[model samples]
Target: MKAQFPIFDICKLSRCEQEDIFISRLAPFLDKHQNLLLSHKHTFYHIVLFTEGAGSHDIDFQRFLVRPYQIYFMGPGQVHSWSFEGKVDGYVVNFSTQFFQSLLLKADYLDQFPFFNGNVAEAVIDLSTNLHPLILDLFEKLVHESETVQHLRQDMVRVLLVQLFIQMDRLSFERPVHQATAYNYTLLRNYQKLVEKNYTSLKLPREYAELLFITPGHLNALCHEVLGQSAGEVIRDRIMLEAKRLLTNLSLTISEVAYQLNFADNSYFTKFFKKHTGLTPEKFRDGLFNQLSQDALSLQ
Candidate 1:
């Protein structure tokens, strides 16, 4: 199959870019997108729910046929492409990373949400039947910003985002942790944010600890207490995930990918990758390619 055409971040639209979000119904453009199957890299954050149509998304190698009210997480740096038949309709809520960063200051508990891992996770309850109206209303408010009265625009947006996060929190599998942390909890949370934002760059624990205004030891202790993993371990997982993403999606050679990942040399990157994957880079790629070919042959 041909790789899909490139996808753009909707927030980059002229008007929407200023507001940090873009929302639109899908049916109108579904005809253009369905056959073309335009897919490529994206860096913005979003949560797309199919409110009115039955369609599908090609996420990595997983093809999820999106039914009505199905919600899929659109994380930063993940590659996603779409397709549908006539009148394919849904709502796309595009938001900036800043929006989520600030929201996490409050609903950080979503860190345990499992569906964010490039999988089509179903919500336990079909909240979209009720929640869709709220999102539509919020989108209307966002659409007609001129109507936002003096001193009320930011206030309205803050409330709207909070509501959205609340809905997401309800869907998370982790039983809610209502005990709002005291002053010290901020350290781990901030450290987590740092890891998320700069994991590709910061290889050492001290780098993150210094940024969070804490010692390496304290950072390690906090993560171990709450997550059963040290700060370094968390950083490694994020880096390794990015590495795997490139390996699976891009056509770059191992040495080229290693340089892009900031390894001092190919050998070091190979060792690091093998440590986690239990196979050399060449063997790993061959294994996945073989699996894909076998699946294709089986389908035939």
Candidate 2:
């Protein structure tokens, strides 16, 4: 498929060469990159530990209201944006998959964290006041080590990230509602990974079920049981997500977006998008531009 949602390169966005990990304060980062921050997907993992903020963050169309002492996580390719009423005080961490591979041999090291599971569950964690200091300290150390040129700085960054991940994982399990049977969780995780990799080419739920060696009905059942949605919803949501991302790029025309997504024609794409999102492509793009204009005016 053609480019979906303008995949941002970590090094280019950070303006640093050969750096896989990017960390900075949320307010300043948002200030500098406000134009690109809204309505685009990143090629790197996004972690933001918010110390003070009241906002609403959107991840793949799922909305979560943000509060202080909470952390938000978004895996690569997930679209996210934030709207806040007041200043946001926190640390933003962006790291590529390469950063993980450099430290560990396992390909699934990042998958161990529940927040990165691609499913809609536990993407945001509300931290206890007692744990705030520990989390803040870890982020501060990472920022310092990232700026300082020292022996094994990369190694040190990786260690700090692993530590942060471990802490978050521990807290994830403390919430009983986030737990799932191992078998079902594994099935969903595998399905999500396949969807992430092949959503553009393989659009059918049965295709994913076939690849997973399961019946389509069984897959749907598992999805409904685990995620409160059907297998078809999951697949369609992924497709529509890319559609929204492509729509965000004003450079691409409606027909071009449809063609890149492999839709038979513009009409079919508009029908599909409207059925899911309740808005045609043109309307959605227009609404986005209108909202952006209003935000800019507010700044003025």
Candidate 3:
């Protein structure tokens, strides 16, 4: 059977102009608990700002806790899930890659910040006592402006984000050279985000180069310089992750999964899946189910 990737909930996407948009979803998991049971791999990447509540988040195979005043940046293709302790209060800021445009964080530099990576992961942050007030202040202004001065919310959100980004970038353990590449980082970021969203649909580096007005070779150079992987690698990685999601998550037959991912036939899907994970469709499915059953029995 072919594989299909999970779909995201982000309905619209604006260009990389302005700062960002804010929708204060203060309601957490209670009666309002709308858990996104992705029966498949998730597609639209987004972020989470925890205002209040305790929860555990699982990204791919990693697990972490979510605390208050913490922010996480997630990208388009990451397989993630979360469970809140009773009422989980937070803001689900589902922004497009266009908004995250590689300006602030390069794809390579962002490897540690899984929240921002397109593969989909939730990061947790619990700022020290000295920095708590700063985040609180920003959150207050964001909520206040959201209610009162609705006009200036976008700019305020930008400032708040810049604060968090700066702090997180500082706390990162990367060397000074890696941290100092903030210059024109957003341009690279925009390019990266563009590719993450459209790489599957838009083939060829030149296609992306055309959109960015740069040559394909130059774009490839930049990708390798920053991401340590070729542009094609990044694209293929996203597609492969999506394919895995479809093959493993949903119970759809291989043919359906293949068509959803735009593959021409089951043979192509099998070849692609086998290329990434040396196992054929039947073997992969059997292994996944076997693992799940073992986990279930262990819990029992």
Candidate 4:
């Protein structure tokens, strides 16, 4: 039998009675869990802010250079690993999926934040010099609240998190272009959510269009206008991303991966994977292992 990839939960990482959330300073957290340097998946949402640090962290196979005043967010089930060049310190919070459901009126309130939408590109943020004090203050309060047994401590933490998210979202808007109107943006986001939920079984833009009550042409045009990709390309990209993620697990063979992705056979899967990624599934897996081995050796 092959070894399964590690998946950690907030309950296992914290001793709090609720076990729904865990918060700590980054340096101590790293000292306690050095194994985090290796790739692992988390069952809880993760937020980290680097007050001081220098290193690289990988999220879903995408590597990002670490810097001071940088914050990153990861939703459940995303694979991540870290490597630090020197002393690293920050604030880290891990919370369950249901952490805010009871406190907030909207069950999907967290999804409104772009960082939590599973787009790695938008998830890691670098704060401007002027915004540094504000961001730092919020994190400091969060740490203090987590350490104290005060009235409505959890509620306070939730409020702080929402404030932090709103601040970041506001910063994101300062970018040069905001093409989609409010109605179109909501529609596009909803379409993306559907694709994420049904990517494995539904492999066409038309299928997703029907679910969204929009014509396939409108869907394709919206994707191209906002995302610079066709609707079909978006679906294909999601399927390809899942394929890459599943391939990372050494326990599963290529054929097994195909079956899980709803492909009829391994051959077609190989063709599709290679055509999109320029590497066969076997080669991709082999290269991934080799790269990991190199990373381990470098650390040693």
lDDT of 4: 0.86
TM-score of 2: 0.84
lDDT of 3: 0.60
Q: Which ten residues in a row have the lowest lDDT in candidate 1?
A: 116-125
Candidates, ranked, lDDT = 4, 2, 1, 3
Cα displacement (Å) at residue 102, model 3: 25
| Model 2 misplaced stretches (Cα beyond 4 Å) | 1-14, 27-41, 117-121, 174-178
lDDT of each: 0.61, 0.82, 0.60, 0.86
TM-score of 4: 0.92
Top model by lDDT, which number?
4
The candidate that achieves the highest TM-score relative to the unseen native structure: 4
Model 4: per-residue Cα lDDT at residue 148: 98
My TM-score estimates for the predictions, one after another, are 0.60, 0.84, 0.55, 0.92
Where is the poorest 10-residue window by lDDT in model 2?
A: 1-10
Please, what are the lDDT tens digits per residue for candidate 3 over residues 1-300?
232334544442323232345345657322342435222234454556677778677665356787886676665556665666766676655544554454555544434353465443224555666766776666566556555656655566656666656666565424332432564344456676776668557757778788888887877877776667777776777677666666666567888877777777989989988988898876877765565455344435
lDDT of 1 by residue, 66-185 (tens): 677666666666655565644556655566556555544655444444344332332222444666677566545654553345576645665665666566655552332212344545
Q: Candidate 3: list runs displaced more than 4 Å.
A: 1-56, 60-70, 75-79, 83-130, 140-184, 210-217, 248-251, 281-300
* Candidate 4 Cα outliers beyond 4 Å, as residue runs: 1-4, 15-18, 294-300
- At residue 275, give the lDDT of candidate 2: 91
